[model samples]
Target: MLEDLLLQGAQPNYADNIRAIAARWEALIPPARLGDLESGDLQAGIVSILESGEVTDDVILTIAGDLASLSWWRGPPLRDDHRARLNALTRARLTRLADSLEMAPRKLPRSQLRRSHVLLVGNLLDPLHSPSGGAIDYAAALASDTAVSRVEIVHSGEVLPAMRTYIEARLGGFPASRGVALVSTRDNPDFLADILSRGPCTFHVWCEPALSPAISLVSRLGPTLMFTCADEAPVQFADVYWYFQSEAHIEKVWKAHAAPQEFIDRYVRILALPSPEPRPLEPMSRASIGLPEDAFVIATVGNRLGVEMDEAYITGIELALRSQPKAVWMVVGGLPDYLLGAFEQVLGDRFLHVPFSRELDRLMTTVDLFANPFRAGGGNSANIAVGAGAAVLSLSRGDVSSLVPDSFIASDPEEYFRYLGFLMDSPELLAAVKAEQGQHNARMRDQGLFLKEIQGLVRLAADRYEARGCGAPLSTTVFAPLTRLAQAG
Candidate 1:
């Protein structure tokens, strides 16, 4: 019997290996007779051969289960159990595989990404599913470009227990491969170890201003690329030709001195939503949210999160409520806690809160009026706000006011209340304003060509990487003054 020879220690795949011989015979023998094989010379042969090779009882039990049920060869039928086993096996093999293959991890060159794999590192302004997470959205577009072969992401914002936990969370259940690397800020030295010892490439993508010790590590690592969107001047960081829903922002950047003359000369990009045939405003839906049947709806969405210059948002809301007792104010998007707390103390009962939704295009249909109480920030959310067919009452904060024209710009609560109340009281005025907005929205739709310009900037980054290899770290010092010039200009 093979058991005698297995006792002399033969490898599993060898002809003399009792385990292989038992497997061969077990497959040949009938299912009902497999029970007999378990106890007789055949079974003993398998056990003695397995024991000689130091295979545990677990192995023999597995073989027995396979012969009995004919399912062991296929792994656990339940997906979760199967996946867990797979992950365990993968982890067990990684170190041995690395050692046996002598596959040393490669470092990302400091200069450029040309043919190298690039990992986008940043906090998702919205989850991956949201259309607005520009990082992911742009990355998806870049996937079709041949310049990139591999794109991995390291979402460090999702806090985890350790570097391993962080990597595991981000790996999103994919098996690790040699082409992917974790782009991290240096605060995670252990992650750095994991990279140098086991990774294929590494780079740090700095997403914020204000250098932290973590980012300084990128400077030490020679070939890292640092990118940030926090430049004071929009054109300094973004292409001047980017698509804007509002021409006001596009023009503002064009006039700003911080933008390169080269950019200004060719800045014709503006992305506009398609303009569908206009329709009459849908019937008032206020009755659904507990607004009185007679109450008029006035809605607004903007940087209600917080801005020291714009503390009059709550004041404007109170003014609207006082001016029109039957007015229901629906606010969408994030609101600052302090403002919310204050509003709750004053007019919380009269206000309805709806978090920001991509469905704004549809939700705008139900509103009767839109009031923008922004007292600061020159760039307005009015473009899209107006696109929804709502007449806007905005603060004429410099160039941002051009986002909506023939609209009231109120400096105080009294002025805000006056225009908002007038619009509600006069249906004729509201109708005229809404009609004008429809025309403007159509004009804006023509600006959709601007998105290609944004794509052009990304392409520029990709091309530079290819031509020069990863080059020296750009001088962060030079961009600071440029941002200041943009603000003054």
Candidate 2:
């Protein structure tokens, strides 16, 4: 019934949502039929259900689902007119029912969270969750904190085996040992109740159009935060922060998105990650990717998608290859044919593409200089290569700039070439650059530092919820976009 309207780009209207509620209720509860009460009659029928005082599972769902949808209006007016139309007394009665149903929360008893029963929500379980690197780091960072009672994940229902391997290797013991649950339910319909059961969630779902109904449900939880993993998001919330790639480089991005200044002022940065053991830099050669031992290899990796950065990345590589006789480029991740063709014209046997690797550290070990793609940028791959003591020549343009060091992240395209040219001109400079970045990488790996930030964010969330007063009827998509009016019963 709702499909035709939704296909034409309509936000769910009152009639549309009421139809769904009536349909579902009728389907679920046969004997207690919603007879002819489909659209305009739904409000009265719903009110009558409460009057009967014999609530069943289906009845409560019909109420809760309707209320959640009722909360979906986004506007300058903030509150919904449909909700406001009811008399104050009727509104109070509805609010009380919501409170009783646990659809609207109140203050969390101190015992309820206990540092937290954490729920880390994200879209994918592959690659430790963030290709730009926060998900992997934050998971480890949250685990490293002794104060955080548990570490669980709500992914898009697919738990790759490598994710378990990464957790076990990085955190010692996981899933079983710590009772670290992986609630694989990012977009699942049945996941709402399970998520509501877990307090203090950190969702990787950001200010984007793809915000799932389940995610919107979690937003109503007192302690929830939206973490951005991409450059653009169509929607935002009151309690939103980002996956910090750099400590001091997010201003441009926040501005680009027209994020509220108040939100930006109180914004949290990316938490640090424990430095994974670097691939040994000693006697480095091209043997890992089966290249000649004598080659001066420059590598770039990750899902280097989108065509915007193709020109810059190819040009940087070609310049280096042309200048240095033995210089070759090894790339991983699926590159577009145009990028490959661009390389072939200027760099024949000098350019090679490696298949995607689960153990990306192995690929980093082969890179003498890592050239990060321009527009799409890098975070996870950049972290690994730099941590592995590989010298990196990264983009100054995009989100990748925030993920890399300012000292190394070049603002000028010329900087990428200059650094690559310097290394090509004097091979001796390579060791010193690696030595410097390795020291920086070691400081970044501090477990205590990462844990402190994670614990602080966790504690701050609980504290903020407390200060704001718990279970303060949250708006689903934005703050006060639609309020469920409460009238005295």
- Give TM per candidate: 0.45, 0.67
Q: Where does the lowest 10-residue lDDT sum fall in candidate 2?
A: 73-82
Candidate closest to the true structure, highest lDDT:
2
Which window of 10 residues has the lowest lDDT sum in candidate 1? 69-78
Query: How displaced is residue 28 in candidate 1, in Å?
Result: 73
Clashes (backbone N, CA, C under 3 Å), per candidate, total 13, 9
Query: Quick one: RMSD of model 1?
Result: 23.6
Runs of candidate 2 with Cα error greater than 4 angstroms are: 1-105, 110-114, 123-125, 128-137, 164-178, 186-188, 195-210, 229-234, 238-242, 245-248, 274-290, 305-308, 397-399, 473-489
Question: Which residue segments of model 1 deviate by more than 4 Å?
Answer: 1-121, 125-132, 141-154, 159-231, 234-284, 300-311, 332-350, 353-365, 375-391, 396-422, 432-451, 458-489
Tens-digit lDDT string for candidate 2 (1-489): 322321121122234555565456555543443453444444555445544545653354345445434333211111222232222223233333333435545677554454444444454445433531344545666665554556665555565677666655665654343435556654565665665565544433422222234443444465655565434322334354645554244555555545435345545775455445444645435665678888888877765332334456666667678888998888776655555676667677898877567666766777788777664446667767877668876666554554445556676777778877887777678887777776766666676776776555555666666655565654322233224432212
Clashes of 2: 9
